[model samples]
Target: MSLFDIKRTKFNSSEVISDFSHFKRRLLDEVYETKDELQLVCSSTGIFEQFIEILEGLFLHIRQTQTSAPKIRLLFPKSKKVNSFLEKTNISDLPSVEIQYIHEDEFQYFIAGVDKSISLFSEPRRNFERGFNDSFFNVISLKDSVIWHNSAIFESLWKQSILENKVKDLSRELNRNNVSNHNFVRILAHELKNPIQPILGFSDMIQNNKRLDSDQKNELLKIISRNARKLDIMTNNILDYARMENNIFNLNLEIFDIVQVIEELLGDYTLQVNKKNIKLDLDTLSKKIMIKADKIRIIEVIDNLLSNSIKFTERGQIVISVRETDQYIVVKIADTGCGIDEKNHKKLFSKFYTTDKLGTGLGLYISRIIIEKHLGRIEGRTNTDGIGSSFTIKLPVK
Candidate 1:
C-alpha cells in the first residue's frame, strides 16, 4: 500500500500518522496550514539533498500564506552535513527560518509541531527511507502539558549547547597562550644565567690574586659590581612582574624631584656610556619639577628607557628632558639609536616581546605597568628623521 494508505490503516480516526513519508508530508502541510507558529526538532535531517527540499518547501509555504504568516523555528543536532546544507539552501536569504544546532548526542528522536492543534514524534533514523522502518512513529495529542514539556526540553538543550561551544573555544585559546608563555619563561631563565657566570668568575679571580696592583684590583671589583647590579635588576623585574599580575603590587606615592631622579639614574650609567663613547645629556624646564608618585617605580621607568637607548645606540647621544603642564608632568627620553619599525611600535610594551634575542623583554612591560599605576601613560614613536625613537611619559599632578 502507499505511505498515506498505510498511515490510514495504522492510525485511529484522528490526527496521528504512522508512515514516515506521510508524517513528513503532513508536517510540511501543517506548516503551510498554520496561522500561528511551527516548530521542529530532529537528530539529523538526513543528507544535504533532503534538507534542501525541506528548506524549499518551508519557503514555499511562507510564500503561499496570503494572510499573516506563522513563525517558524527549526532545531536540529549539529552534523557534518550542516554547513553543506546551509550552503545549498542559502539560509541567510530566508529570515523567517530560525535554526539552532545542538550536539548530535543530545537529540535522539524526531518531533514537530504546528500551533496547539498537532504534535508528532518518531524513532530516530539516519534517513527518511521507508524500507528501513524499524522503530515506533506516531502523532500525539496537542494538549497543553505535552506541548509545554517539549518546548521546555528544546529550550534547555539549546542553551546548554551554546555554553558547551563557548567553553570549548575558550579552552583552545588558553592552551595556545600557555604554550607561548612556557617558551618565553625558558628564554628568560637563560638570560638570567648570562650575567651570573661572569660575576662568579671575576669574584674568584679577585679573591685568589693576592699580588695584583691596587688599580687592577679596583677595576676587577667594579666589573664585579656592574654584573651583580645587572643580575639584581633582572631578578627584580621578574618578581615585580609576578607581583603585578597577582594584584599584590602596591605603590608608595610620595612627592620627589623628578629632575633629581633622572639625574641620579643618569649618573649610574655614566661609566657604561663613557666606555661606549656615547653622550648622555639631560634637560629640564626647572631644577625642581616636583610630582607625587612612587619614587622607586618612577626611577625604574626612566632607567628602563635609558637602558634600551644605550643598548641600541653604539656611538650616539641620549637626552632626558622633564617639563610640567598645569595638571601633568611630562618626561621625554629621546635617543639617537637604531629606531624600531613602525609596525612594531604598538607591540613594544607587550610582555615577553623583544627585538634583541638575548633580552628578557620585561623592562618595557614593567615600565608601562608602573606608569599606568601612577595614573599616567607611556608611549614611544619613531623620530621624524627615522634615526631613533622617543619615549614620552605623562603623569597626573594631582
Candidate 2:
C-alpha cells in the first residue's frame, strides 16, 4: 500500500518494512516467483469482497494478454467457506488461471513463478514494472537471495493473511472517473471566468482615480478589488484543475535561484503580512539556491500557500525554509495559524474546500496542480495539537 510514488525508495526502507502490515486486511502482496507457482497473500478484515473483485478482474486482464504465463497456481490458507467461495468463481471462463486449494493439513512444496524481476505491488496509476528493492511483505522465496529472504518472512504470516484483490478494480474505476472529470474541468473552467474580466477592470480603474475623495475611493476600491480578485482566483482554480486532469502539464522549466524567487514574491505580499502584523521571515541560508522550475507557476503556488496561512493567523509568524538536495529542492512554509482538522487532510487539494470566511477555496488546489506539473509535490500538515499548519512544496532540483 505505497501511497505516493512508483517504487519510491527512502533511507528508511528498513523502518518502512517494519510497518508493512499496518493496513493488515487492506493490503495485498501477490508475488510470481517462477514458471511453476504463483502466490497471493492478502490482509483480510473488511474489504474482502472488493479484494476478490479486483483479483478476478486481474485474472480477466491476464486472459486478454497473450503472455506465456497466463497459467497461475492459486493457493489459499486452510478455511472451509473461504475455499468454497473460491471454488464457485468460474475459472473456466478464465482459461489462464490454474486454481488450487492448499489445505492446512498437508502441503510440502510451493514454488513462486516470478521471471526476470518481480513486482509484488504494481499499481496501475504508475509504471507497472516499477518495484521496491526491499520486499516489505512476508513472502517465502525459493529462488534468489532477495526473494528467499522476503518470502521466509511471508511464510510465517501466510495463515494470518488472506489473498485479496483490493486495487485492480479500483484502478479501473478511478481511471474512468479521472478521464470524465478531466473533461468536465476544462468545460467548467472557461465558463466561470468569462464574466470576470470586466469586473476586475472596473475595480482597477476605480482604485486608480485621483479625482475621487481619498477615504471613500480607498474603501470602494477595496471592495471592488477584493471581489474581483476572488473571481480571478476561482478562474485560476478552474484552469489549474483542467490542466491537472490531462496529467501532462509541463513546468516550462528553467534554472533560477530559490532564494530570489521567494524574495520577489514576498515583496508583493509584504503588505498583507504587515496587515496581519505577522513576522514573516525567510530562512534561505544560501543567497542563490539554484533550481530548475517554472517561476510563474511556483510563484502562484507560494502566493496561494501564503494566502492560506494569512487567513488563519491572527498575529503569528510565518517561516519560509529552502533546502536544496541532489534530486529535489524542499521548500517549506510553516505558519502559526488556526490549524486544519485531520479529517480535512485528504481534501486539501480538492477544489473549493476552504474554511476561511472570505476565501474561494481554489488556491491550494490550483497550487497543487502547478506543483505536480513541475515534477514536484505539495503537502500540508497541521501541528499535533492543531494550533498551526505547514505547507511543503518539493521541486526537482534539476
Candidate 3:
C-alpha cells in the first residue's frame, strides 16, 4: 500500500501474528520519527499500560537527540483511572506532553497521529478472552486529506475541553463563596440582636421610671446611646456587604486630592488617638497627590483601617503614609498595636470574622468591598518584629 493510502490492521485472537509486537515494529518508529507534532485521543485507561514501551522509546530518542521533540498533545475522557495513570507516570513532567480531559460522551474512540504524514484510529474489542497481555483492538491508518480532517476534529475537541474545565472551576468557587456567606448571615443576625435587646430594655425602663433621679436617668441614656451607635454601625456594614454580594455597589467617582483627605481624617481622629495616649503621624511623598474615585467611600475605607489600628493599640503610634506610582495611588496605614496573629491574616476580610471579642468583625470586610468597587485592593501584613500590623491599599490611576 502507498504511504498516504488507507490501511486496516486488526489484533484480535484470530490475528495472532499481528499482535502488540508486530504493531509496534511496523508503526511506532515511523510515528515517533516525525519531527513536527504528535496527537493522541484515548477513550479508556485499558490501553494506557500497553503504550509504556512506545513512550519510553519516544522519550529516549528526544533526550539523546538533544533537539526539540515534536509537540505531543493527548486528550482523554475524565476518569479516576486515567487521573491515577497520569499521576503515576508523571506525564506532566514529560518533555512534550500536553494533557486535557473531555466528557466521555464527546469522545468514544482511540486516535493517534504523528505530523500530517501518518495517523491511526482504533475501535476497542469488547469480547476479548484474555486480559492484560491481550491485544484486542483494531486500528486503521489514513493520510493526506483524511489525516488533516481528523486533526481539525481533535483541535475542536481540545478547545471544548479547556472551556469545560474553566466553567467548572468558576462554578465551584461560586458555590463555596455562597456557603460561606450563608453561614456569616446567621452570625451577623445574632450580633445585631445582641446589642438591640439591651438598648430596647434600657429605653423602656428610662421612659417608665417616673421617680428616677437625674443622675440615674443620665447613666441609662448614655448606655442606650452607646448600644445604639453599635447597632447603627452593624446595620450599615450589613447593607454594604449585601450590596457587594449582589454586584450592585458602584463607586461615585470624583477627582480629589487624596493627601488632603488623609490629613483631614488624621486631624478628626486626633482626640480619639489622644484618649489612648497614642501618637498619630502622617508622612506624604507629596503634599497633594490626586486621584479620581468615590471620595466618601475612600474615606470610609481609611476610617475603618485607622479605627482598627487605634482600637488595638494602647500606648504606641499610628502612622498614615501617602505615596503615588505612575499607575497606582498607594496608601499604607501602619500601627504599633497588638498585632494580629499570623494565622488569622487570611480570614481578616471575611464577613463577621474577628480575632477580638469587642470588635463587630464587619469593618475590614466592608472596607474591602468599598475599595474593590473603586477598582482597588486592600492587603494587610503583620510587622516582622511581631509588634504591629500594616495595611496597604492600591487604587488604579486610570
Candidate 4:
C-alpha cells in the first residue's frame, strides 16, 4: 500500500511490514514529509552504512525540491568499520545532519522518527533487507505516545554521547601533551650534557698536563672558556623561558650603544669564524646608535642570531648590518648558510621547535619574546639570493 494509504488505514495502530521494497519506500516518504526534525538510531553497522547511502540521495533531493530542510540527528553504534566509512564518505557534510556514536551494547534496535508523526522500529538482524522486512512502525496525525517515548530516549542518549565525546577529546589532548613534555626533557638533558663534557675534559687537561707548553695551556683554557660559555647560554635560555611562561620575566632597560655590543660580541667569535674559514662582516652607518631598551636582552638576541649564522655557514660570509629608518632602528643579520626551508619559517619562533639536533630550541622563541616586550619586532626569512637566510630586528627609535 502507499504511505498515505497506510497512514489512513493504520491510524492510531501499528503494523508489521514484511516487504523490504515497500518499507524502504515508506521510510523515504516519511523523511520527505518531515518539516522540522528527523532522528535515526541504527544498531547494525552494516545496515547503518546502507542507510547513510540511501539518505545521502534523499537529502540531496530534498535540497533541490523543498524550500526548507529538517534537522537530521543520527545515532549509530561505534565500530571500526563505521568509523572508516565516515572518514571516507561526505554524508556528514550534509548541512542539516548531526551524528553521534554509542557503544554497540548500549542499543539493540533500529529506530527512525519524523517530527512527532511517524516512527519505524526493527529488531536486530544480520542484513539490511531482512531487518527492514521484519520492521514494525507507527504513523499518526495526532500526538502519539509511542513517538513521544522514542523522542525522550533519543534525547537522553544524545546527552550521553556528547559527554563521552568530550572525555575522549580531553584524553587525546593529555596524551599529546605528555609526549611533548617527554621530548622536551630528553632534548634539554642532551643539550646540558654536550657542553659540560667538553668543559670537564678541557679543564682536566689544563690541570693535569704539567709538561705542556704555555701556548698549549692557553689554547686549552680558551676551549674551556668557550664550552663554559655555551653551558651558560643554554642554562640562561632555559631559565628565561621558564620566567616567560610564568609571566615574571623583567628586562633591564637602559640606554646603550648597540654597535659597541655587536662589536664586542663579534670579537669573541673571531676564533670560531676563522676556524670555519667563513668571513664575518659588520655594516653600520653610525659608530654608535643609542637606544633606550634592555641592553642585556638585546645582546642575547644579537648573539643568538650571530651564533646560528656562524654554526650553519661552512664557507660563505655572514653580514651584520645596523641602519636607521624614520621610525625604527633596524638590524639585519644576513648569512650565506644552509638556509631554513620555506615551510618552517612560520614555526621558527615557536617554543621547542628546532631543526638542530643539539639545540635546546629556545633561542629564537626567547629572542622574539624579549624583542616584543621592548616594543620591537623580529623576523626571519630566506635571503634574496636564495643561498642562505636572514634575520631582521626593528626597534623603535624613540
Candidate 5:
C-alpha cells in the first residue's frame, strides 16, 4: 500500500507512524497542498533543523506562484542553537514568515498544521543524541475536532510568546538606562567643576596681587566674567531640564526680526572668535525676516549652535546664514571643524548623549525642545563638503 494512503491506514482518526522519513514525507506533502495558512511549533533546535529546508522551499514556492502568499507562523523554544540557526540561514527575513520564541519549559512537542484541515504531532525522545527517529510517536489527525483543538493550542501559545518577549525587552532597556544615568552623573560633576575652578582662581589672583598693573587686573576680571557666564549657562540648563520634566516650561512669544537677533548674538561671540583666530561670517537673504516665537528661547538655540561650532572649530571659518521662503524662515550655522560621525547623527539631540568630555549633553537636547515648542524643527548633519558640520533651524514666518 502507499505510505500515506489513508485507505491503507484509517479514516477520520489518528494514525501513528514510527518511521521519521515516512512522517517527514507525509508532512511535506500536506504542506504542499496548503492553500491558506501554515502553523508550526518545534520543541527544540534539533527538531527545527530537520524541517527548516522544507519550510524555506514552501516560502519560495508560495511567493513565486501565488498572488497572495499565506501567513506562516513558527514557534520555537528559546535556545542558543535556534538563534544561531536563524542567523546563519536568514530564514526570518523571508516574506510572510513570523517567528517567536517560547520558554523551553513550556514547549514539549513538535506540531505542524496546514489550514485547519490536517496536523502532525510528534513527541520526540528527549535524548536528542540518540536521534529523533529512535523514539518518535507521530500522530496524523484528519478529524475536525482534533484539528480545531490543535489550532486553539497554537493561538494561546502565540499570545504567551508575545508577552514573554515584551517583558524581556523592557527589562533589558531598564538595565541599560541605569548604566547610562550613572555615567551622566559623573560627567555632570566634572562639567560643573570646570567653570567654578577658573572663576575662583582668577578672583583670588585679583584680590592678592597688589603690584599688578591696570591692564593685568582688567584682563583677570575679564577671565572671571567669562567663567561666570559659563556657570550661568550650565545652571540654566539644569533648571530648564527640571521644568521640562515636570511639564511646567512656558514660552514668552513675541514678533521680532530674526536677522537682527542673530547679528546681536554674533557680536557677543566676537571676543571668543577673535581669541581663536577663526573667521565668522553671516549671510542673510534680507535685512529683516519677521517671525513669531519665544525670543529668548530662539536666541538660546542659536547660541547653543554657535557655541558648539566655535568649540569644535580650531582654525577654520564659521558661517551663519538666514533666508526666508513664502511660509518659513531658515537659519543655518555651518563651520569648518571636526565633522560628526554619521552613526552618531541621530543621537545628537538625545538626552544624556555627548561627544565632548566637558559637555553636560543637555544643550542640544534643550535646544530641540525649545525649537519644537515654537512649532519649529532643527537638524544637524555633516557639511556637504565634509570639512565640518552644519545645523539648520526652520520656523514659521508670521
Candidate 6:
C-alpha cells in the first residue's frame, strides 16, 4: 500500500477540516513561500543517509535552475563515527552550493535553514513503523535576524565535536571495512565448529565410556544440542544481514495476521527470558489484524526487538504490547533495562552501529529496511526516568 493510502485510513475527512491538515498545510505553505537559507537537521543515521541522497538530488536541480539561490546547509550528528562518515562524503563536486556539517550532540534536533526558514527534525516519541502519524515538524523563518540563535547553538556543538585529525584515505578505510567483514566470516566458521565439535566429541566419549550415568550423558547431550542451535541461528543472522546489506533481501508480501507474527517471535523470546529469569509480559491481542507485508521479514523485526529487549533487561519485566488503529497495527516491545542516552537513540537503527554489544548490528537496520519496503516505519523511545526503552513498529492494515 502507498503511504497516502495508509494516512487516509487513519485520518478521516472531518478531522482534516477542523484541525490537523489545515495546521500542517499552513506550516508547509509558509515554508514553500519563505526564501530563507536552507538548514537541515538530520537526527537519525537512517535520516543521515537519506539526507545525503536528497541533498544530492536537490543540489543537482538547483544547478539546473537559472535563478535559484544558494540555499543549503547541513547539520551532522556530533559523534566520532558520524564525523568519519561526513569526512568520507564528497561535496566538492557541488562547488556553487555551500554545505556545512554541524554536529549537535546535545540538542533535541538539528536546525535546518530551508531558504530563509529554519526547519526542525524532532526525534519522535516512538520510532516503530506505526509511529509516523505522531511525528511533528515545525518551521520558522529568520531572514531579518542577522544574529541567529540556532546558529550559536549549532556552533557551540561544532566546536566541541573533534576536528578531522586523521583524513583516512579511501583505500585505507575500505581495507579496514573489508577486514571487519572477513573477520565476521571467519568468526562464523569458527562459531559453527564450536558447537559441532563438542557434540561429536561428547557423543563418541559417552558411547565409549559406558560406566557414566545416563543422566550425566543426557545433560551433556542437551548442552550440545542447545549450543548447536544457537550457532545455527547466529550463522543465519549473519547470512541474512549480508544479503540485506547488499540490498537483495527480497520480501514475499502477503496478507498475514500481524498478531501471529508477534506471537511467533514472543514464543522464541519467552524462552530466552525464562532462562535469564526476567519477567515477560504480553497483552492479549486480536489474532486477525491482517496487514499486507513480507511475513518473514516482519517476523525478523519482532525477533530483533525482542532479542534487544532481552539483552538489555537484566531482571526487570519485558513487555510486548499490540494495538490496532483504524488504518495501522502497532507493536511495541519495551524493556526495563539500561535506557539509552538522548544522543545515541537515533544511531541505534543505523546499520553496523552497536553499543559495543554482542551480535552483528545489522538486525535493526535490516528490520527498518523491510518495514520501509512494505510502506511502514520503526522507531525507538527511551524512558523519561531511565527505566528502560521501547521500540515500536507500525504496519499498514490492508
lDDT of 5 by residue, 161-235 (tens): 653344344335436656445465556556655665655566545544558787997776666567556656666
Q: Estimate each model's TM-score.
A: 0.54, 0.44, 0.45, 0.55, 0.53, 0.48
Model 5: CA > 4 A from native:
1-180, 210-216
lDDT of 2 by residue, 1-398 (tens): 22122123322121123232332222223432235344553332122232455556555555556365545545544465455556676554565564433334221222233442332331122221353222233222222323332233233233112111112232344467763334333333443443344344443344234366756655554544444444445445545554565574666777777798888767656666787799888997688998777877787788778767876788789888988888888989888887878899999888656675444455787787788777789999996666799999888766
Which residue runs does candidate 2 get wrong by more than 4 Å?
1-233, 246-248, 356-361, 384-386
Model 1 ranges with Cα > 4 A deviation: 1-177
- The digit string of per-residue lDDT tens for model 1 on 30-146 reads 667777777777665452233356657876666566356667777766665776666665654565667777656433466667785666665533334554344334565454434
What's the true lDDT of residue 19 in model 3?
A: 61
RMSD (Å) of each candidate, 1 decimal:
25.4, 24.9, 24.9, 25.7, 25.5, 26.2
Clashes of each: 0, 16, 0, 0, 0, 24
lDDT (0 to 1) per candidate: 0.69, 0.54, 0.67, 0.73, 0.75, 0.56
**Which lDDT tens digits does candidate 3 get at residues 1-398?**
11112233222211222264566554576666778888887655555445657755765675566456778798876778777766766767766768898666422355677786666655434423355334444343442433544554465456446534443443454477764444444454456556656565665555445577878867665665555545555555555655676788877889999999988778766656777899999998688888999898898789779878988889889889888988789999999988888889999998667886545566898898888777789999898888899999999997
Q: Between candidates 3 and 4, which one is better according to TM-score?
A: 4
Give residue 109's error in model 2 in angstroms: 88
Model 5 lDDT, full chain set: 0.75
- What stretches of model 3 exceed 4 Å from their correct place? 1-233
lDDT of 6 by residue, 15-111 (tens): 2222323434543443344364555556555445434544455545555652654554555655665565545554434544444454343323324
Q: Candidate 2 or 3, higher lDDT?
A: 3
Ranking by lDDT: 5, 4, 1, 3, 6, 2
lDDT of 5 at 312: 97
As a whole number from 0 to 100, the lDDT of residue 129 in candidate 6 is: 51
